[model samples]
Target chain A: GDSVTQTEGLVTLTEGLPVMLNCTYQTIYSNPFLFWYVQHLNESPRLLLKSFTDNKRTEHQGFHATLHKSSSSFHLQKSSAQLSDSALYYCAPSMNYGSSGNKLIFGIGTLLSVKP
Target chain B: GGIITQTPKFLIGQEGQKLTLKCQQNFNHDTMYWYRQDSGKGLRLIYYSITENDLQKGDLSEGYDASREKKSSFSLTVTSAQKNEMAVFLCASSRTGGAREQYFGPGTRLTVL
Candidate 1:
């Protein structure tokens, strides 16, 4: 079974500072899709970015993440943090194709606290 | 441009009771999924359907049953609720299968006494 690990349980950053949420995965599947999802308070988790091609940076809503297959990592990054960026972030991995209906295996969420 | 609507934002049930949660999607997606989220934990896959009338068990489908009777709807039932079983159930849909990004609905919080 595939598993995702997000090492940071809580991250506190000052506004205007850089942001990074660590995400790593372990899987036996050759082709893996790495994903980043953001969930605000009382809201559903929404896809922020997904990557299939290794080493390619995927950006969405001022956030960027690159899938590093060699390192088995897909760490989410942002150059600047915003107060509104406070949310719970999840890292997920999925098998390629409809093999398993693209079921995602998620990591324990990381709560981002952006302070003023 | 689409929304996944999950009825009853909160649910309270008794032990050994059967509870059902309904989800509706207007995106006409081909795939729908049910996931359970525990407090401060990751979401666990329960069941997924590729299309109408199709069902597949996921990693956490042991105590749950899912029905996809129509293209736009999917429902999950807890066979027997357990005491202190509190979690949020999320519904999601994707236009195509295989590594596609999923659109999620506001989850339903279930509390069993």
Candidate 2:
């Protein structure tokens, strides 16, 4: 079984401040795909970024994450926070099961709130 | 480019009532999934279908039933709605049963009284 963990439940930041949301995962498979999904207030969740290559930084919008196979972590980071960046972020891991289908195990999610 | 559509943006049901949620995808994807999202609990996989006529129970499949009527459609039924239950049901689809990213629908908000 595979699982994802987000250490922070809620993160409050001021506008223009740096943002970091920790994410780690557990999977038996050596190769796993990690993803960050974002959901705004009253909106459906959408893929922010994803990575399969270890130690490679994947960036989308203003966020970036590097998959670290050694640490089993894919922490989301941004240099500057925007008011619009306030949303719910989910850390999910997808493992290949051949014909069984690749299922995504989502973390409890971290809510990021940016204030002026 | 395609979209996943979930019917009935909102649903209100009484306790112990059986409720059904519908999902349709135009991506022509081979796999469809149903997930339950609760506040602070994230999204939990309820059921998934690799292909038409195929169904797989997920971690939160208990008290729920699923049907893959066709390659483009999948439906989930709640065996018995629980009192005070409030959650969102999301439908997603992927190109194949591999490591591809999933596309999600707008979701159906459910509330049980």
Candidate 3:
């Protein structure tokens, strides 16, 4: 079974400060697709960044994450936290190549709080 | 841009009753998925369809059934609702599956009492 883990359940940061949300995964599949999804209050989770190539960095909307196969982690980081960046973040692992019927295993989710 | 629409933003049902939730996608994607999200929890896949008339059971498929009669629509049915069962059901679609992003619906909140 594939599993994703987010170490922090809740991360609080002040606006203009650095942000980092940790995500790690364990899967037997050689090529696993790692994804970061952000969910605003009462909204569906939206894809923020995703990558499969090991050690390659993926960035979107001022957020960046790199897939590290050796470390089995895909940590999301942002240079400056924004008031609007407050949301729930989830990390997921896609079963090989994201084919039809392939399911994504998601982590519990981290509640990110940024205070202005 | 395409949208995934789910009928009946909220659903209320009695225990042991059967309930159905419908989802429609204008994306024309071949893959549609049903997921359950509990409060403060991650999304769990309930069922998914690859194409018309095709159905696949997901990790949380027990006590649930899904139908894919058309390419743009997928429906989920709860055979028997249990008391105190409350969660949100989300519908999503992805273009033909190979490493594509998924577009999600607003989600339907279900309450069983």
Candidate 4:
């Protein structure tokens, strides 16, 4: 079974500070796609970004992550933190949906708090 | 732009009672899923249906049952509620059961008395 681990339970930063949320994963798939999902207060989780290419950085909406197969990590990062960035972040590894019929394995979310 | 709608937004039931939650998706997706959200536990997959009448057990499917009566609808039942239990149930749909974007519903909050 594939699994994801987000070591940070809470990450706090002042406005304009840098953001880094560590995400690591474990799976047997050779082409594992790692994803970052953000959930705001009372809102459903939405895809922030995803990547399958190892060492290739994927960026979206001011956030970025690089999948490193050697380390089994796809850490999310932002150059500057904003108050609107406060939310719960989850990392997941891809699995065959039809053949495997398995649900996405999520990390114990990391809550990011940005203060002005 | 499709939406996933979950009924009753909130659910409150007695311990040992059977409760069901309904999910409807207009995306016409081939796959639908049920997930349980607990604080600090992130989200755990309960069940998923790749197509109508197809049922698959996920990691956390023990206490839950799922039915996909139609392509556009999926439902989950909590066989027996636990006293003082509280958790949020989320319904999601994907174009396929493959690696892709999953559209989610607002979620149904459950509380057992």
Model 2 Cα displacement at B6 (Å)? 0.6
> Clashing pairs in model 3?
none
Residue A75 in model 4: shift from native, Å? 0.8
Can you write out model 2's per-residue Cα lDDT over B1-113, one digit (the tens) per residue? Answer: 99999998999999999999999999999989999999988888999999999998889999999999999999999999999999999999987744578999999999999
Ranking by DockQ: 2, 1, 4, 3
Q: Candidate 3 - CAPRI tier?
A: medium
Q: Please give me the DockQ of candidate 2 compared with the native complex.
A: 0.80
lDDT of 2 at B92: 95
TM-score of chain A of 3: 0.94
Question: Model 2, A1-116: lDDT tens per residue?
Answer: 67888966889999999999999999999988898999998888999999999999999998999999999999999999999999999988887788788788887899999999
Per-residue alpha-carbon lDDT of candidate 1 for residues A18-65, written as tens digits (9 for 90 to 100) = 998999899988788788999998888988899999989899999999
Q: Interface Cα RMSD for candidate 4?
A: 1.7
Cα shift from native, residue A56, model 2 (Å):
1.4
Against the hidden reference, what TM-scores do the models get? 0.92, 0.97, 0.93, 0.95
| lDDT, candidate 4, A1-116, per-residue tens | 67788956888899999999998887787777788999999999999998889899999999999999999999999999999999999888867744745456787899999999
Backbone Cα, N, C clashes tallied per candidate: 0, 0, 0, 0
Off by over 4 Å in 1: A97-99, B97-99
lDDT of 3 by residue, A1-116 (tens): 78989956789999999999999899998887888999999999999998989988899999999999998999999999999999999988887434445667876799999998
lDDT of 4 at B75: 99
Which candidate leads in lDDT? 2
Q: Write the per-residue lDDT of candidate 1 for residues B1-113, one digit (tens) a residue.
A: 88899988999999999999999999989899999998776788899998899898988999999999899999999999999999999999986655678889998999999
Alpha-carbon lDDT, every model: 0.89, 0.92, 0.89, 0.89
